[model samples]
Target: MSHAEIEIERRDRVTHGDYIAKLDTSDSTAKLSWTDRQGVRHAEHTFVPPEARGKGVAEALVKALVADARQEGFKIAPDCSYVERYFDRHKDLSDLRA
Candidate 1:
Protein backbone atom coordinates (compact mmCIF):
# COMPACT_ATOMS: atom_id res chain seq x y z
CA MET A 1 0.00 0.00 0.00
CA SER A 2 1.13 3.56 -0.56
CA HIS A 3 2.16 5.53 2.53
CA ALA A 4 1.25 9.00 3.59
CA GLU A 5 2.83 11.95 1.79
CA ILE A 6 5.30 13.02 4.45
CA GLU A 7 7.48 16.09 4.20
CA ILE A 8 10.87 16.00 5.92
CA GLU A 9 13.21 18.71 7.08
CA ARG A 10 16.19 19.12 9.38
CA ARG A 11 15.25 20.46 12.75
CA ASP A 12 16.50 24.03 13.08
CA ARG A 13 17.16 23.40 16.74
CA VAL A 14 16.05 21.15 19.54
CA THR A 15 13.70 22.83 21.97
CA HIS A 16 11.58 20.37 23.91
CA GLY A 17 13.27 17.50 25.67
CA ASP A 18 12.97 13.98 24.17
CA TYR A 19 12.19 15.30 20.71
CA ILE A 20 14.88 15.15 18.06
CA ALA A 21 12.50 15.07 15.13
CA LYS A 22 8.84 15.62 14.38
CA LEU A 23 6.10 14.81 11.86
CA ASP A 24 3.02 17.03 11.73
CA THR A 25 -0.10 16.44 9.71
CA SER A 26 -3.46 18.13 9.52
CA ASP A 27 -4.73 16.08 12.43
CA SER A 28 -1.66 14.61 14.21
CA THR A 29 1.99 14.94 15.12
CA ALA A 30 4.83 12.50 15.75
CA LYS A 31 8.09 13.04 17.66
CA LEU A 32 11.41 11.34 17.20
CA SER A 33 15.14 11.46 17.93
CA TRP A 34 18.36 10.70 16.09
CA THR A 35 20.51 8.87 18.63
CA ASP A 36 23.95 10.34 19.01
CA ARG A 37 26.98 8.68 20.59
CA GLN A 38 30.48 10.01 21.04
CA GLY A 39 29.73 12.88 18.68
CA VAL A 40 28.49 10.44 16.06
CA ARG A 41 24.85 10.23 15.04
CA HIS A 42 23.82 6.60 15.13
CA ALA A 43 20.08 5.89 15.35
CA GLU A 44 16.73 7.43 16.18
CA HIS A 45 13.72 7.30 18.49
CA THR A 46 10.25 7.66 16.95
CA PHE A 47 6.99 8.06 18.83
CA VAL A 48 3.70 8.16 16.99
CA PRO A 49 0.55 8.80 18.92
CA PRO A 50 -1.64 5.73 19.25
CA GLU A 51 -4.28 7.49 17.23
CA ALA A 52 -1.78 8.23 14.47
CA ARG A 53 -0.34 4.76 14.20
CA GLY A 54 -0.59 2.84 10.90
CA LYS A 55 -0.48 6.08 8.97
CA GLY A 56 3.28 5.75 8.22
CA VAL A 57 4.53 8.70 10.23
CA ALA A 58 7.26 6.65 11.89
CA GLU A 59 8.36 5.29 8.54
CA ALA A 60 8.64 8.77 7.14
CA LEU A 61 10.59 9.99 10.15
CA VAL A 62 13.02 7.11 9.83
CA LYS A 63 13.36 7.72 6.13
CA ALA A 64 14.07 11.39 6.71
CA LEU A 65 16.69 10.62 9.34
CA VAL A 66 18.35 8.11 7.09
CA ALA A 67 18.45 10.60 4.26
CA ASP A 68 19.83 13.26 6.53
CA ALA A 69 22.52 10.93 7.82
CA ARG A 70 23.51 10.00 4.31
CA GLN A 71 23.66 13.63 3.25
CA GLU A 72 25.96 14.27 6.22
CA GLY A 73 27.97 11.08 5.65
CA PHE A 74 27.05 9.32 8.88
CA LYS A 75 26.14 5.78 9.82
CA ILE A 76 23.05 4.63 11.69
CA ALA A 77 23.04 2.59 14.86
CA PRO A 78 19.25 2.20 15.07
CA ASP A 79 18.58 2.13 18.83
CA CYS A 80 14.90 2.22 18.09
CA SER A 81 13.49 -1.20 17.21
CA TYR A 82 11.06 0.23 14.73
CA VAL A 83 13.75 2.30 13.05
CA GLU A 84 15.88 -0.83 12.72
CA ARG A 85 13.03 -2.75 11.17
CA TYR A 86 12.30 0.15 8.87
CA PHE A 87 15.79 -0.24 7.50
CA ASP A 88 15.45 -4.00 7.31
CA ARG A 89 12.35 -3.57 5.19
CA HIS A 90 13.88 -0.91 2.95
CA LYS A 91 17.32 -1.87 1.71
CA ASP A 92 17.78 1.42 -0.13
CA LEU A 93 17.94 3.10 3.25
CA SER A 94 20.40 0.67 4.81
CA ASP A 95 23.36 2.63 3.50
CA LEU A 96 23.03 4.71 6.64
CA ARG A 97 23.34 1.71 8.97
CA ALA A 98 26.42 1.29 11.10
Candidate 2:
Protein backbone atom coordinates (compact mmCIF):
# COMPACT_ATOMS: atom_id res chain seq x y z
CA MET A 1 0.00 0.00 0.00
CA SER A 2 1.06 3.56 -0.56
CA HIS A 3 2.14 5.87 2.24
CA ALA A 4 -0.99 7.88 1.70
CA GLU A 5 -2.99 4.80 2.42
CA ILE A 6 -1.28 4.43 5.75
CA GLU A 7 -2.05 7.45 7.85
CA ILE A 8 0.57 8.11 10.50
CA GLU A 9 -0.46 9.87 13.66
CA ARG A 10 2.17 11.82 15.56
CA ARG A 11 2.32 12.42 19.27
CA ASP A 12 5.18 14.46 20.64
CA ARG A 13 5.56 14.41 24.41
CA VAL A 14 8.72 16.23 25.30
CA THR A 15 8.07 15.87 28.98
CA HIS A 16 8.26 12.12 28.64
CA GLY A 17 10.99 12.21 26.03
CA ASP A 18 9.01 10.22 23.50
CA TYR A 19 7.91 10.84 19.92
CA ILE A 20 5.32 8.49 18.55
CA ALA A 21 3.79 7.86 15.15
CA LYS A 22 0.73 5.74 15.16
CA LEU A 23 -1.55 4.27 12.52
CA ASP A 24 -5.34 4.39 12.52
CA THR A 25 -5.46 0.73 13.38
CA SER A 26 -4.42 -0.73 16.68
CA ASP A 27 -0.92 -0.94 15.27
CA SER A 28 1.40 1.91 16.14
CA THR A 29 5.05 2.92 15.91
CA ALA A 30 7.06 4.87 18.44
CA LYS A 31 10.57 6.18 19.05
CA LEU A 32 12.02 6.87 22.45
CA SER A 33 14.51 9.68 22.83
CA TRP A 34 16.91 10.68 25.58
CA THR A 35 19.58 13.30 26.00
CA ASP A 36 23.15 12.42 26.84
CA ARG A 37 25.61 14.25 29.08
CA GLN A 38 26.92 15.89 25.92
CA GLY A 39 23.36 17.16 25.24
CA VAL A 40 22.69 14.97 22.23
CA ARG A 41 19.42 13.26 21.44
CA HIS A 42 19.47 9.52 21.10
CA ALA A 43 16.86 7.44 19.36
CA GLU A 44 16.79 4.67 21.88
CA HIS A 45 13.96 2.45 20.75
CA THR A 46 11.38 1.90 18.03
CA PHE A 47 8.38 -0.34 18.30
CA VAL A 48 6.04 -1.61 15.57
CA PRO A 49 3.18 -3.95 16.28
CA PRO A 50 3.20 -7.40 14.68
CA GLU A 51 0.19 -6.58 12.57
CA ALA A 52 1.97 -3.51 11.32
CA ARG A 53 5.00 -5.47 10.16
CA GLY A 54 6.08 -5.45 6.49
CA LYS A 55 4.02 -2.32 5.87
CA GLY A 56 6.85 0.21 6.10
CA VAL A 57 5.51 1.54 9.38
CA ALA A 58 8.84 1.20 11.13
CA GLU A 59 10.64 2.96 8.31
CA ALA A 60 8.15 5.77 8.48
CA LEU A 61 8.78 6.11 12.20
CA VAL A 62 12.52 6.24 11.70
CA LYS A 63 12.13 8.78 8.93
CA ALA A 64 10.07 10.99 11.22
CA LEU A 65 12.72 10.71 13.93
CA VAL A 66 15.46 11.55 11.45
CA ALA A 67 13.53 14.54 10.25
CA ASP A 68 13.06 15.76 13.80
CA ALA A 69 16.74 15.22 14.54
CA ARG A 70 17.70 17.25 11.51
CA GLN A 71 15.32 20.09 12.25
CA GLU A 72 16.24 20.15 15.93
CA GLY A 73 19.99 19.99 15.22
CA PHE A 74 20.59 16.77 17.11
CA LYS A 75 22.31 13.50 16.21
CA ILE A 76 20.77 10.06 16.47
CA ALA A 77 22.38 7.15 18.28
CA PRO A 78 20.00 4.58 16.70
CA ASP A 79 20.05 2.23 19.67
CA CYS A 80 17.25 0.13 18.25
CA SER A 81 18.21 -2.67 15.89
CA TYR A 82 15.53 -1.62 13.45
CA VAL A 83 16.83 1.93 13.33
CA GLU A 84 20.40 0.61 12.96
CA ARG A 85 19.40 -1.46 9.93
CA TYR A 86 17.53 1.51 8.60
CA PHE A 87 20.68 3.57 8.81
CA ASP A 88 22.55 0.83 6.95
CA ARG A 89 19.99 0.96 4.16
CA HIS A 90 19.88 4.73 3.92
CA LYS A 91 23.44 5.90 3.72
CA ASP A 92 22.33 9.45 3.00
CA LEU A 93 21.21 9.76 6.62
CA SER A 94 24.64 8.84 7.92
CA ASP A 95 25.35 12.48 8.58
CA LEU A 96 22.70 12.40 11.27
CA ARG A 97 24.30 9.48 13.05
CA ALA A 98 25.94 10.15 16.40
> Which candidate has the highest TM-score of all?
2
What tens digits encode model 1's per-residue C-alpha lDDT throughout 1-98?
Answer: 13445654455333212333233543556766664665456555678878667877777677666666777676777778897788788888766677
Clashes of each: 2, 0
lDDT by residue for model 2 over 5-53, one digit each (tens)?
6544555545336655566667445444444435456667777677767
Clashing pairs in 2: none
Candidate 2 lDDT (Cα, whole model)? 0.68
Count backbone overlaps in model 2: 0
> What value of lDDT does candidate 1 attain over all alpha carbons?
0.63
Give, for candidate 1, the lowest lDDT window spanning 10 residues: 12-21
Whole-model lDDT values for every prediction: 0.63, 0.68
